[model samples]
Target: MLQILGAAHGAGRLDPDEIDERQNAVLRAKFVDELPEQIDDLPEGAALAAELSRQAAAASGTGTGGTARSGPAPAGRDLAPAWKGPGGEILPAHQGTGPERTRVDIMSGSEVHVEPGTPRVLSYALMGGSEIYLGDVLAPGVQVVVETYAMWAGNEIYVPPGVKIVDETINIMAGNEIGRHARGDGSNGVLVLRGFSLMAGNEVKLDPDWRPGPAQLGR
Candidate 1:
């Protein structure tokens, strides 16, 4: 699947950013059924389908396309933390390289203000919760990716109004509740949120009513 996307990108059918997005989707895909959507509208998607069929035949040892086995999914990828602050400490707002800054909470909750200009974030919460406030300095047309995991916990993500949002979270006895609408202005960036929620819930809000404290103002 990635090979086909690479070919499309080399032929100018996909740009660097789109290629990156599709590649990420491919890596994050959990099943054969989910694979088709990632390349559905791409230029060489048909080839991907054929390739997948061939692989399916090989896997089944039947050399025929029948009912494919739906086995247990592989374990989730271990992403690095998103906040580097000490445990239980409120993380101040500051510019960062997205999710490369790790945030891990075992049994406590913390707050964070992510400065704009980053394109990606990876986070995890276990038996705890987090509140992330996005900064307002993002560039137009930039696409930001925020992936997270919540087990027996929840997350509140505050996004600015001008950006577009896509929710791709997969839930297991849990789900996400989005409280904002996509912006009509095409000049804003895109927020791509993907991850898992197990016995937890995640929230995405626009211009959330909550305010930062004096210590949480700036880094």
Candidate 2:
């Protein structure tokens, strides 16, 4: 009678339809990891791709309408400001550490050439009391170039934190009137307390990415 019971219990181990839920789950996960991901090299947007091609020319300040030259402005007009606001100060800040950490590192290199060079000119309108900050370290391994066009005399500008104003020689071929905009020296922390612009022309380059931090740790 004991042998009979033992034989009946052992029959369960011989069944071929038994399934292991844990083993199936592991196999599914491995299959997912082995699958290939699709990446699009050339997207459907022609506008953005054109900008990347002429990045080198823009940064070097050597492309069409890229230079700023000397000028004798009308009365009551002043040139670019070389300082910041009365109480302005440069601040240093970032997001987080480890996974949340971000860095702007632009792998310096020449981009594709702009054949027949039709460079886009930007127009921005900045009030006299407003300030501007140029940030470059949010993306990691990147550099940025900013440009502006004049509408009315937008002077008395103020530079904010994370801004490095650089007056580059990228516009050697641009006309004198077109070249007399603003300037910066490519420093780490700079303040532009004065400038002139129109509307919507305030553009900035992001070689990597950009991340803005808080002013200070609460009082």
Candidate 3:
């Protein structure tokens, strides 16, 4: 199958001399998903995807066709932020990367806030350093205590009483973190939430008492 695909790549257009040979070989390598009834010869799924790849490669001047000439997919599986999937597609595996930073000028009594639609992800990231607090309040909310090695996933950050999650998703209520305990390491293996979907006029808020604290390191 591979060799046959290679031949198609080097062949520019269909050669009358090799037409019969190429067609026979391609037909043999075709993957079986659906078989044509009554028709003496028909292409299969593998043949189709391969043909598309080939055409794309040829158009790009790769001079090759089908599987052999195909380019690599974008790195990062699923096309999500945290983890990547086969062919390097970024899949929705971790929390959103938002509210990149929240800064405040206590000295001048000034505040720089990220609108609720700013940052959404609350990565359980401790790699660059422990949870960071950048803004007006010394610590508007404590970092949610989580295990650096504990099990977790990326989804909605359920902010504690003192925190607010702001991302492209719906506005998380003040005093509450929408996505709590996100996975930073390999274990943040799933995509459970794509941000909050809220009703208009209704508000979301964190409980009056819940506070964030540094997560305890696990054994």
Candidate 4:
């Protein structure tokens, strides 16, 4: 997808902002099925889309968006979070035990990338913000939980395809923006996002437009 966007930029059809959007889409795309939708409208995008379709077909010969796991499976984990920082924290492959947890304090922002072997996560945000990116490393039929708390600040969660979410979050004078892709049955893993958003704007979305720094979490 990036290659196609680069070609479009070289052809003088896409501006910088357009290229950035397309690149972000590719990076945030969690499944092959979501790939074509990200770049099927730009110049020479038809060819790109066709190429992507071929790639998807090759990847998922079973046509389930390649959700099936081949070869031996790794050991599952009920991951426990080792408290890190107020800055971005990308979770390493699953290890350890206990309840997965983390926190972000005043004026700070952080990120947690969901990988397989890890279990439920508990996160806190107070006068600060955080972001969670769900990858497709989960085992089939496995459900992972993610709990969050946001107060006087904003929080964003990005989900990919095939993953299921059960959002039992409560809000008090706060706002939330949930994207279309975040809704689904418990087919894949379950991301039970339980939290409180008070006096702030919080969001649970799917494949959000990616950006740099704190801007990635958006407003």
Per-model TM-score on C-alpha atoms = 0.47, 0.19, 0.17, 0.52
Worst 10 residues of 1 by lDDT: 75-84
Clashing pairs in 4: 79-119, 81-100, 143-190
Clashes of 3: 45
Judge candidate 2 against the unseen true structure and give its global Cα lDDT, from 0 to 1.
0.25
> What is candidate 1's local distance difference test score?
0.58
lDDT of 3 by residue, 37-153 (tens): 111122322555544454445544565532333333223211112122335432332332334442222112222222222332232221121222222121211122211110111
Residues 1-219, model 1: lDDT tens digits: 655666677788887678667655654444554465566677678766655545555555556556665332333311111111345232333333554446777777788776656656667889887787663433344566678888998777776434566679899998887763323132334567788989987787654232222222222
> At residue 2, what lDDT does model 2 achieve?
14
**Predictions in order: lDDT:** 0.58, 0.25, 0.27, 0.55
Off by over 4 Å in 1: 1-99, 181-186, 208-219
Clashes of each: 9, 41, 45, 3
Best by lDDT: 1
lDDT of 4 by residue, 79-198 (tens): 111122235333222322434556565688877676545566666778887777755333234556666677888777776433456668788897667655455343333566677778
Q: Rank the candidates by TM-score, best first.
A: 4, 1, 2, 3
Sort the candidates on lDDT, descending order: 1, 4, 3, 2
Comparing 1 and 4 by TM-score, which wins? 4
Instruction: Return whichever of 1 and 2 wins on TM-score.
Output: 1
**Given candidate 2, what's the lDDT at residue 210?**
22
Clashing pairs in 1: 81-101, 81-102, 82-101, 82-102, 82-103, 83-101, 83-102, 83-103, 99-121
